[model samples]
Target: MRRLALVLLLVASGCRNGGAPSTEVAQPPQTVRNPVPTAYPSEKGDYAVTELVHGLEHPWGLAFLPGGGVLITERPGRLRRIDPDGTVSPPISGLPDIFVDGQAGLLDVALSPDFGRDHWVYLAFAEPTFRGNKAGTAVARGKLEGNALKHVEVVYQQEPKLSHGTHVGARLVFDDEGHLFVTQGDNRVAAAAAQELDKLTGKLVRIWPDGKIPKDNPYVGKSGARGEIWSYGHRNMQGAAIHPRTRALWTSEHGPQGGDEINIPRAGGNYGWPVVTHGIDYSGKPVQGSIGRSTAGMIDPAYVWEKSPAVSGMAFYTGGLFPQWQGDLFLGALAGKSLIRLELEGNQVVHEERLLTAREERIRDVRQGPDGALYVLVDAPDGKLLRISPVGR
Candidate 1:
């Protein structure tokens, strides 16, 4: 039924009557996933914008190190490791050759669930296009060696890659059973590809450790589609995380001009993107009115920012550094140039507070470190690797 809604959206959007392919019109570039430029390291803000690490160019994704440190990935294909002492390690080798044009580049990174046992890590990155300018998103597994990736393996790659480079809202997370969840941006070109079961674009895909589509996935047993499909109707979802306790999945996605969203993902649910939006194109063209009349069967966002903040990374608070903030949802704002903390009283967004808005820095990612402290990555040439904790009274 959700797939049908994607079809209806394509039809309604003056795209086409059926899920047909257009030879001439390449899919929109992954505009939804592209990291927009901003004035990071804001000079003044409500919160103190401390600089953790500098010399980064266009940092976009982050993961905390085992100790008091962080691992940050720059869109230009460099991975820097920053220790709690503020020492920055050189770029880790063995990263895939990212298209690195616009939104395409080395994206999300995460340690293996049993990192203590194996020290393995996984990454979501875009590759040079197989056809046209379409660089496909792929997942790879490796170990962090001295200053490089070891035992690297490209577990999965999107097939029939298109010729566009945009909207690869790629994020990596693992379920309780150890299966990996990957959110692929719609390739920004193939909007209908979101509906086409044969293609992986604009889709939420599930795979085993080795990148094989899961046999028991919801879409398994269905015919004519990749069984890895966990859900559909997403434009470009960049943020993904599994609840440390509930085992539920949550995601953050980018909308066109205004309709950015945060969604709690359910298997087989459709998240309306171009079809149903809280926003329109940058041209002010009306793509959707409100969350009310999007394609039938599409799920509305749990919350939306009327003017897109271009949210990228998200982390739920589970640290002891701020006992008052435990269980809160924190998201990095790129276009909004700040860090947003959403207070929840059991799934109800009861409080909203904007941190570092005075700094006006483009926050690309927020994360909880191993020692239960908060870490944030700024996107800029002089981007800072920041640490947030409670100020002792």
Candidate 2:
């Protein structure tokens, strides 16, 4: 049904080659899930933002544990634990050697879905090689033991490492079916590799928890193609989250100068990064060989911000703490300096609002805690972890 909506949107926006009006209106997807309660208190200016922890260095990703604590990944290659009461612990040791270059370091952190029993913590970082001094995204897993990591193992690594540090996308997400999905960037200059199935760059890869490619993956049994690829033709996708009800995988990726986009990536779909973009080069020139928007077989974005927000991390709101925000989507903005909220009616974005605009903080990540509160990670030299809750609570 969401695919139908995309087709209808493309037709309505006259994004087709001939610009002919579409006759078929797509029907909305049936709401099989229970309806979300609509009593929204935060929309009435009844909420308060509290700084929970401080003194962190550019915290990138955040995930809550099954019990109470939170795990945070610092971009400079450190993992820290924050207790439920807001006490920050010493950095966890036994991490892989990471390249601490610009936008290349420890990126995302997530616990195994069965963390309570398995105690596996998965990490993705920019790994440096000694041969060519190049770096690429790598995934590893470790066991939590007090203040250190134990029994660490590398799960996956992008092949043919590149020398650039700007676009090493390393967002991690677990789908509803218990498979791990990792988003990789175009390595800043390898946009052509995005269309190549043999390379893992500029792709969404799905794998089993222990670094094995799923036998049922889209590209399995195909010769010369990586079996782990779920989708391709992505730029630098930094934020990803699975939908609460629809079970769709949504992503926010950085565009060149003005075309940051949000997409519901499809299996084996081409997102047309440098091929067709709403963005231009950093010097305000058009993308090379760009046709402005749609191409022959590439998919169009579900939503796009004409002026780039430098979108970083995103999550779907399903918690009851903010009833009005239920089923909505939240995305962190690095250059826009706010938390952007999207009101969704099915897969289509119906409305948008920017939060924390006045504070002017570059939001790095957004997560809904186990206790139903929203936790936001700020991007700064001295980053902060903030908890946003009701004002009079």
Best prediction by lDDT: 2
Best-fitting candidate, scored by TM-score? 2
How far residue 319's Cα lies from its native spot in candidate 1, in Å, is 1.5
TM-score of 1: 0.82
Q: Give the per-residue lDDT digits (tens) of candidate 1, residues 1-393.
A: 000000000000001111122121122111111122222332122222234445556667776545334456666565655443334454556654556667776677776878768877777777665333557778877877676677888898876566255887788888898889998887866666776777788888888878887778878888887788888878888888776668688899998888888888788787876668877767777753334436678888888888888988888888775677778898998999988888887655787777878678898888876656567878876655665644321
Q: Return the clash pairs for model 2, or none.
A: none
lDDT score, candidate 2, position 86 = 34
Q: TM-score for each prediction?
A: 0.82, 0.87
- TM-score, model 2 to reference: 0.87
Q: Give the worst 10-residue stretch by lDDT in candidate 2.
A: 2-11
Error of 1 at 19 (Å): 35
